[model samples]
Target: MSTHRILIAGFGGQGVQFAGRLLAHVGMYVGKEVSYLSSYGPEMRGGTSNCSVQISDKFIASPLVLEPTELVVMNGPSLEKFEKTVVPGGRIYIDSSIVAKPAVRSDIEPHPIPATALAEEMGLGRLANVIFCGYLIKKLDLCPLSALPAILKEVVSAKRPELLEGNLQALALGFSM
Candidate 1:
């Protein structure tokens, strides 16, 4: 069985763990073995946060991920911290709004998307993480687009039902890009 490990890192409010949870849920819904682990600094909103997710066709050996197959970084600090931990030939997705500098590695492919700027334009600036999720799914063929609506709906909060449409829109916009 093959396992695909993903790492997502960003500031505390960037929804790094949320994006990781989405991927892990999608993987499980598709019948794959999945594990997710999240870590963050004690500084709360502005502090660093990250999550590791592993999806596999067989039982997962561990939840920890030291070298990821793909890395999603939403800020300059995150990029600097996690860039070297990606495996050679791995893929890295950077939020161009916060990460202006490009990765120095030649072996990995880099995708720089202006997530925050685009989300602000959509009147949902906080949905940047959802946008990144859409981009990652589309770029990596992680899951079917048709599966997102149901899963998203299921996971979204009952009190914040209005955000679901915005999240869907953000996801579609990112996928189109």
Candidate 2:
């Protein structure tokens, strides 16, 4: 049982906090001790947003993540701000469609996923976060794939029940990538 500290960052509308929550929930659902913490600016859509998630087999001491073991960045600014925070030999997931530059560190593993472009191709641009979620789970081996659809069903709103299937599809697509 190892501990994982993850940081997800992007603009407000990019679902950075949502991604963090998804990971934390999945960790808890799988019987791991998990903590999720998030911060965002006043600007609703374009403001900087970030979340920290910690998962461990034992009790978690704190929710704060000063140095992340894993990281996901949806845009250039987030990449710049958080790339150095990733621990050496850790993994960094980047939304390649939005972030033009690569991480400066050479020790960490970088996975560049074209999430926005993939979402656009799927005709559901808003599903990029879900797709990234799928990719992250597969990359990190966080939880069983079967667990995600149930989690999606739980978190997705009743008002937009129609999106459940699409989100699942996006998740599958991302996992396959």
Candidate 3:
């Protein structure tokens, strides 16, 4: 498999880390090399936060993504901050529900999704991250869509397995939208 660098960006508490974790887990589950790291400071919860994950069939040289192949912009400011760094032909997914007026350059492929709105519509106000993840999995074609339900099941608990079910529903919803 080719190396794929993915960046998930937003303010802290938006589940940026969780999304990255899921990606890393899926990569490893498929026997691919993966690195997942989240940037954190005292201000992370109130200020900016982001995570980087690299998935590859070969050895990865760096964990820091200087020119990511895919950027998941979970907020407007994040898109502004990272847009210039994305390489040409790279894919960008924006959470249009929370981010307004996401700017664009000519080279990147931007796929906007109303993640927060979708979560709220499903009565899952805290699941905007899940929605975005689903959309990313679909649009980026990160892995086979069949792998997503299993990924969610792997991350969620038996005590609340419906949460995983809901997440799978959200992923399917996002994928189809």
Candidate 4:
């Protein structure tokens, strides 16, 4: 009986909602009860955005994640806004490339990854969110790595077929981290 309440936060164009959706899809594929809720500011592109995703073996009572077991922050403001919302002993994944600050709390575990830098180095700068997703997938053991390609195909092939290869590579790179 495992339950993960995950909150992903970043700028509107940083794919925060997409990452939440991906995690929700993964939970469904693995036969877990899931809930996803997305929120954003008035401005579409550069404004604040976030999404909460809950994955559990049992039923999910709500979509709001007040105390996340897992938190992923892609920018400094987001880190500041949501850092304290993580439960004690929970995990926080930070994009060190964009966020210069460190986690203030000592009780939670902080994983600082240069996801944006790594993705840029791989020539896949737009896929940083997916990179973070890959890292979360590996660290959380939410699903088998082998199952990711099929899932990626199912998610991205219809809308953006050309990005599948780069997304796959980004996931692999993040998993290796």
lDDT of 3 by residue, 4-51 (tens): 899999987788888888878778877889998887756476688898
| Local accuracy of candidate 2 as per-residue lDDT tens digits, 5-103 | 988888888888777887887787888899998874453355788888998998888888879988989989988888888889999999999999988
Cα shift from native, residue 62, model 3 (Å) = 1.3
Q: Each prediction's TM-score against the native? A: 0.92, 0.92, 0.88, 0.94
CA-only RMSD, every prediction:
1.9, 1.8, 2.0, 1.6
Instruction: Estimate every model's Cα lDDT from 0 to 1.
Output: 0.85, 0.84, 0.81, 0.88
What's model 1's overall lDDT? 0.85
For 51-91, candidate 4 gives per-residue lDDT tens digits of 99999988889899989999999989889889999999999
Worst 10 residues of 2 by lDDT: 39-48
Screening candidate 3 with a backbone cut-off below 3 angstroms (N, C-alpha, C), the clashing residue pairs are none
The numbered model that scores best in lDDT is 4
User: Which parts of model 4 are misplaced by more than 4 Å?
Assistant: 40-46
Pick the winner on lDDT between candidates 1 and 2. 1
Best by TM-score: 4
Stretches > 4 Å off in candidate 3: 41-46, 157-162
Inter-residue clash pairs, candidate 2: none
